[model samples]
Target: MTGYLVRRVGQMGLTLFLIITLTFFLVEAQPGDYASFYVLNPDLPPDVKEKIRAAFGLDKPLWQQYLIHLKNTFTGNFGVSFGHFPRPVMDVLAERIPRTLVLFLTATAASFYLGFFLGKAIAWRRGGLFEYVATISGATLFTAFTPAFALMMIWIFAFRLDWFPLWGNSCIGGLALDILKHMVLPVATLTLISFAGTMLLTRNSMLETIREDYVMAARAKGLPERQVRDRHAARNAMLPVVTSLVYSLIFAIDGSVIIEGVFSWPGTGMTLLSAVRSEDLPLVMGAMLFIGCCRCWLT
Candidate 1:
């Protein structure tokens, strides 16, 4: 187990290195740097543009910039953000990370519980109408276009029914209840789309597990049906489901980019989007690196 863990960690380190390198070059390859808007203005003289580049170290050669970025990344010094000027990249991300965690973690828990419960029920009663209905519905939802579904949910719940706020993270006063209220639509959107996959996986796993010899032995021993199902079948079926749960939680960090954007949530996802649009290389690179690290180590 020690050797296995060491190997996994080493692989994750290599993957993270590749992710950092690729992100740096891709971001640098963009047509203009953070000062492009100021540099491109017709009124700005050549000297001013040169000054702007010098201020941000854009005057450095590409290789030098890459090396500097790599060194800073390893040292956990993500420099000041071009978008949120005068603020360090880490400081900007610090404020946003908690919001993203709250939203995605809550959604993941909700989806897993709902999916697992429904999956077990449907699998246990294999031939029932409820099983068919749930399977069909789950498949449909699993295949739905995420952004469009989110928009439709907003239209129905927020716009048409006025049941929830249209967007944004919180209301005035920043009450916990107000924050939860704002989270409802986006959280529900993510949960609804996600639960289907979990449900199907659980259902399939349960089906296979129930056919195993150990399950039949449990039943043959005159165990109560519920005991036989829960203690025997469901417990064993959980192996694959647990793996799926880990992946869901890890990737949800990256997935938040879209969900947060649609709901106007004040999370890292929205922060990254704004940074990219504004050509904030430090902030963007920091966010990408943070996400890559999460995906790597958390697995």
Candidate 2:
């Protein structure tokens, strides 16, 4: 286990290096200069550009800039935003990380577990009315187009129609009522969007799993169907699901740009989108790198 963990850590470090290297150079070495991000006044002297360059050490060689970026990154400094923000990159991430995590983790777990248990039920009683009806219903409710519409409809019904709050996290009050209120919409949207895919994946995985020799052998040995499925089938079936889940998670985070924007949630997803629109290169690149690291962690 220790050896395995060490190898995984090494892989994580390698992934980080690749991500940072790509993010740093790709954003820093973009086609146009970072100068346009400043006051683009025609009358502003070129000397001002030189001064700006000198201040940020942009006049240095690209290799030197790379070294500086790497050194600063190691020291927990994400460099000054090419735009006006005074705070470091880490500080911005710290502020927004919780919201993103809460949404993403909540959604992922909701999908994953529901997929697991529910798929088990469907499998245990395949060809029955419940399975047939559920499959049809799941297909509609969890269709790809549904997330945006579902969330919006929910907002309209739950918020505009005098139900739940239209926006924001309600976890602050620590009371069950408040927490449940805040979570209702986002959680429902995420689960609805994710449920079908997860369920389908689980159904397929479990179906294949149960066909394997061991499942038949388990039943032959008088092992209960529950034990056969949960112990012998579920774990083996989940391997592919786990692999699919990693990519789904990455895509989900990326897709959260749309979801978070819609909800006006103060998450890293929203922060990054705003930074990108503002051309805040450092923040944009920092967010990109952060997401890459998250992907690596999932991997």
Candidate 3:
């Protein structure tokens, strides 16, 4: 186990290195650097722009800058944010990460619970009307376009019904009830879209597990149907579902960029979008690296 863990860690490190390198070059390949804003300013002279570039190491050669970025990343020195000037990238991310975590983690838990319960029910009664309806609905939802679905949800619930706020996250010291109310739409959207995949996976796994010899033996022993299903079939079938849950939780640290954007939620995904639009390299790189590290370490 130790050797296996060591190998996995090594692989994760290599993958992260590649991600960092590729991200750096791709951002560099964009039309302009972080200094482009200064370059376009009418009041700032060329010399002042040069100084600004030097201050951010934008004046350095591409390879040299890349090396410096790599070193800084390893040392937890993400430098200052271009978008949020005078603030470190880590500080900006620190402010946003908790919001993303709370949103996604809550959604994940709710979705998985709903999916597992429904999947177990449907699979246990495979030939029933419930199975047919659930199978069709789950497949449809699993294949749905996320952004369009999220928008439709907002339209119905927030805009037309006026049951919830239109968009935006809660205030820092807001009422708990207000925070939950604001969270309802985004969480529901995420849950509805994501639960179907889990449902389908669980259903398939349960189907296979129920036909196994152990499951048949449990039934043959005259165990109650519910007991046999729950303790024997569903329990064994949960392995893959649980594994997928781990990956889901890890990848969700990046947050849903489109959903957060659509809802104007001030999470990591929203912050990353703003950073990209403003060409805030340090912030962008910091966010990506943080996400990559989560993916690597957890998976």
The local distance difference test score of each candidate is 0.87, 0.77, 0.85
The TM-score measured for candidate 2 stands at 0.77
* lDDT for residue 33 in candidate 2, whole number 0-100: 58
Off by over 4 Å in 3: 84-86, 212-223, 250-255
By the lDDT metric, which is better: model 1 or model 3? 1
lDDT of 1 by residue, 1-299 (tens): 99998999899889998999999999888887867756767888899889998987789998998898888889999988867555998898888888888889999999999999899989999999999998888888878988899999999999999999897856423888789889899889888888988898999999999999999999899999999988999989999998999899886887888988888898889888888887887899988888888888777
lDDT of 2 at 203: 88
What CA RMSD would candidate 1 show?
Answer: 2.2
Show the lowest summed lDDT stretch of 10 residues, model 2. 165-174
lDDT of 3 by residue, 155-215 (tens): 9999999999986756455788888887898899888877887898999999999999999
The per-prediction tally of clashing pairs is 0, 0, 0
Query: TM-scores for all candidates?
Result: 0.91, 0.77, 0.92
In model 1, which runs have C-alpha deviations exceeding 4 angstroms?
37-45, 84-86, 171-173, 217-223
Ten contiguous residues with the weakest lDDT in model 3:
247-256
TM-score of 3: 0.92
Residue 90 lDDT (model 3) = 83
On a 0 to 100 scale, what is the lDDT of residue 205 in model 1? Answer: 98
